[model samples]
Target: MSRFALFLALPLLFHVGCGAESGDEDVDPLAGIQIIGDDLSDIPLRGASAAQVARFKEGDRLFDFVFRERDGLGPLYIRASCAGCHEGAARGPGAVQKMVLVEADGVTPAADQAALPYGNTMRPYGVGGATTLVQPEDDLVLKLSQRLGPPVFGRGYMEAVDDAEIERVAAEQAARGDAIRGRINRVVFHSKKNADEAFHRFSEGDENLIGRFGFKARVATLDDFTADAYQGDMGITSPLRPSELPNPDGLTDDAKPGEDVDVETVNAVADYMRLLEIPKRAPADPRGEALFVEADCAACHVPSLRTRADYPIAQLADIDAPVYTDFLLHDLGPDLADGLIDESASSTSWRTAPLIGMRHSTSYLHDGRARTIEQAILLHDGPGSEAAGSVAAFRALPREEREALIDFVRSL
Candidate 1:
């Protein structure tokens, strides 16, 4: 059965227990029908072919698989599986530490870092006793940042958003002459990691690709994201990432190194990620909706977006999904800065985090520093961020209206 149909098949009487609802009380009509992460973030979107459904199920199995040294886990690595950092398929308790040497300006990453611990990521775990944790001796001198694994939901829709549309929004924001000057982070691409392998113009001919996923938009596609997580977070090399890096311990259980996992395994996992459903938006209060617009939070946290009709998924094509993001990189001020340059994204720049599944997240921001949504909202100020006025407007709201706004955001 389709995901939506399964939800409708449930008896309606099950919901109207007590004071939570009246006879017509409205929750997300499709609340409980999930392919993965029941009551959480990893549901599959509606309208999958039987074959697609099978792949999604298989992918989920692979995503949760734990690897050992026999499976070529690591000579040098961090965890053993994909699910380790992103347990429950939600924002990470699996924190990825990034170390970068800051130059004299204190914003750009140092050009030469041969003396530093490792490149960008630090993994502390390895196969048995074969791994030494990557801890820099100059921990104070190097700008260290913790990257929380973001929830993997509704990414297919985000992938379907046309590049022209993203550029168009950037132009519109530029035309507005406001503080929100959002830019794209362009990075490199390889064949195995490009989800649309034959499609990306750069992937076909050039190697330069536009960045879309991750806190700094360092990754471009779900396949790339999966491959990167496999190698960087788990120390497991797949066909997508054919080689392993030298760990701090310089240990290896595998005699020969080229391919640890087959390409089919990586592709299966990517397929599952490709279909993850966007959590349904909580019903909005009219007053909170108006305040959201009034506060100019809508300027950056755009409430709705349309996907092109040509997108692969039938249910997702040409749909007006409320994704609540412009997907461009913006500077959220100095407090949020980490000095880690991700491709074109500067140390101060971070992708405007989509608020689609905000209710499921207990921690907020790239580093998971903000515990409350309100604290996160207040952090959106500084020289380059355009949300300073919006922050002031939000702070001035009446207590009831403020709670209403918070409730509205949580509903997403």
Candidate 2:
């Protein structure tokens, strides 16, 4: 059954009585529906065909494959493989640090990053004896932003969400009196060869496509996301991104010259991400769910959005994906600002976090500063933050009610 159908059927399937025996008699809302566990993120989508499952397995192997210097593993890079940052297909210990050149105020970005050749990414490690650490010039003032790797499971659903749905949500939020307006993050299509792989709404000349991936939502397609990571994070070039980044050694190529991996490899990994399933949610506390909406946290973290019917994957097509994100950029306020500029996303702006796998996540927020879900919520309030009203509402709730809300969110 579809998740939407299952969600709607849950209350009717299990009955709870008023007496103490209700606890014992209550049925499992998700019983036989999903496999709930730590490794759930690693599992493929239900009802995948044999060919799709084979591709998923191939992509899984590639995702975990460690690249060495011979395999084009960088003269300057961050990690050797995708799994280095996204361990277990979820948030891992790895973190990417971005150094933004700023003015005297420390918040305003410098005119440009000409002083820092490697751009904002601080790739401290490298191979081929080009081990000279990248450092800033004496005159340049810099602000460092550390971004922990986000969970990768269920992103295919986000990719499949129709552009119209996002636009509709944006229009709805704009009409609201609350200060919770969201803006679509439009980014240019990077790879010409892969342009045809974009959603059907996009044309041959389309430049600024709706970005649905990354913390800044700067990437539009899952294939591009995979190709970008292979090159940017690992310095392994593919057909999509064939050029090597500038390094201290001034090297223009790696040991494996030309494209390190073929388009097929990139597609395989992208398909794997597309096929990965979200973790099964535990039964939610009804009161807690009600309190979450009461606090207005649902304003930005929308409960669900429907995917496009034409999406190539049958499982993801036209489904109500309960990813709990609007997939639009919003100003989170000054306190959470990182002073880093990414495409159209300002330093203080962040894409609404998807809460599908929150129960399994070890960290919270874009930078992973909050260890606990409650801490994440408490940290939401700041001057000029769109979430200020919601945070205030949450704060005013009684202790039990607050716990209930947090518990409900964690259950996602």
Candidate 3:
């Protein structure tokens, strides 16, 4: 049994081992302890309806519930539950290492993945007699990248942003003539959606939609994002993505036959993501805010984007979301490139990471290699990087000014 299975079974053992009278009551020793508000990363959005609150609670429970082999955890898997990688709805220690065959330059991806069949994702664990794992071969692999799971808070507002708004930002950047232009990541929709889902609808025969989620901006909506994580990370199939990923033994099914989870569960999880609120910002230094904009850091990391007027979530609709991302793809140049192509995005291209909860993070950047915010900023000065101009401006600042800017960003 997996650790999660053991955890879930502990409650049953307690119930069976002890028989307390219905009238018996035990007093808690620490019931009067006051709650501290330091960690509000998993709280729901302001002004949520009672019904919305109920759904958020249900989704919260499942997000932390761990699945075992009998629950279709994996013939192959990564972490066991949503919370495995995103503990407390924030960045956890879980990391997925992606490897692929690249060209001689060690930057561009190979023409095809035929040489390495298990695909880019390298699952670290296996179950149900499938012991072989996809480890990187030194001779075959040209490059490898480690991606840490991002926080899920305030995602509802990000998902609610209109495609037109994303396009508007892209167009403005293109017109600026500053090598900082960003483009949208158009991707195919693979998840089920309600007919009246509040999002831009694609015309008949058009499969491409603007993507805003994921490192390369590959996932278009919260529901599909939830479904993809369930299948890809946990190896649990759902109606939206019913097929199991390629495994070593060529196994087509797991311990649980057919789909492991139902549509209701998927929707519940997505709704929970939609209702999560971004952590409130601390007071910003006026000088630092001005310096941040002057240094062009705000070019790709736009301070705010307005959500659609008709967003399904009442609390999230028609508001300026301070996510600090334009949700467009930008090439950070060769030094930061992971050498793994993702759909339309090249190896060096990445979506501008949001800065809503930077104060709570110990690591920075897509791979979490930068231990400090200053180090992450210096990395933007890589050769041929789009943020070169911004980094240059930041370097030109006085020592005190630079420290001020860093403090403002950390307080975000």
Candidate 4:
């Protein structure tokens, strides 16, 4: 379903009403965004109706539910509940390793026969026992990356963004005369329950659709993302996806097929992630903004994007979303490649992680190796790296300027 993809978000193309209302020279940059608050846990969007708020609570409860062996716990899974790895709705490590084994080249993954179920995700914690699990091969892997789970915040805005906006940004970036050419991950989204039964998916025209969620950007909608997470992460099944994971141990799963949990549980969990609030940020620094732009960081990390005016939430509708991301996939270079070409995203390519609520980030990058953001910044040295120039620019700055720039990023 997902690996620890950093806040996967991109630009919103909405215009603000006016600057006079917020008493600032420019319109409130963060107005209509997540309301500033101390608590960083999942919260409802601004101007949410009473019904919406109630539903948010329901979703939050479902997100917090800890499943047991009887409560549809995985026949062969990694974690039990959504909060098991993502404590407090924030990103964290998983029980079993999210392994994506491939050849030394890392781009061409072997066929399913050579790379069985065990090569993908390592199920260290199975409900039944070791006999009913899928473990990794000892020597088959040339490259294996340990993935962390990303925070599930501000995903609704991402879902509401128009596919045309993503295409427009891709064209604009290509026209800028830069090496940064980010393409959308076009995926075939399936129906809630079955792929062939009923599938009027997220396609703009053809069977393929622009994906916006997950580490590899393989999923297109919040509902599908949630279902995949449930099936893959927790081994829990629902009407949407009613099947146990592959058991390479050649043992019985003991769990029946068809369905494990009801459809309401799936929707509730998805809804919680959808209505989740944006991260809180410190006051904006104009100098930092200028420095961010001057360093060419804004080339890929767009400053502002807009939600559709007719969006569901009053607060999110037509509001200025200052999510600093282009939402397209960019190659971070060989140094940071995962060697796993999932769907359309290349081994070195990753979606532009949204910089909003960056203050709450526990670790940087997909693997959570970079303790500090600076280390993460310095790791961008791949052949297809779009941030190479920006990284150079950041390094060339004076100590104070560099610190100031970093502080500005922290403010986001």
Q: Candidate 3: where is the Cα deviation over 4 Å? A: 1-35, 136-138, 192-206
Off by over 4 Å in 1: 1-39, 103-108, 128-133, 138-140, 191-208, 249-257
Name the lDDT value of residue 78 in candidate 2. 71
Which pairs of residues collide in candidate 4? Answer: 4-148, 12-305, 12-306, 13-306, 14-306, 19-27, 333-382, 334-382
Candidate 4, superposed: residue stretches over 4 Å from native: 1-39, 93-96, 105-119, 130-137, 192-206, 249-258
The local distance difference test score of each candidate is 0.69, 0.78, 0.78, 0.67
Off by over 4 Å in 2: 1-39, 131-133, 137-139, 195-205
Q: Which candidate leads in TM-score?
A: 3
lDDT score at residue 164, model 4, on the 0-100 scale: 67
**Which scores higher on TM-score, 1 or 3?**
3
- Model 2, residue 327: displacement in angstroms? 0.6
TM-score of each predicted structure versus truth:
0.84, 0.88, 0.89, 0.83
Error of 3 at 60 (Å): 1.1
> Lowest lDDT 10-mer window, candidate 2?
12-21
| lDDT (Cα) of model 4 | 0.67
Better of 2 and 4 by TM-score: 2
Residue pairs clashing in model 2 are none
Worst 10 residues of 4 by lDDT: 9-18
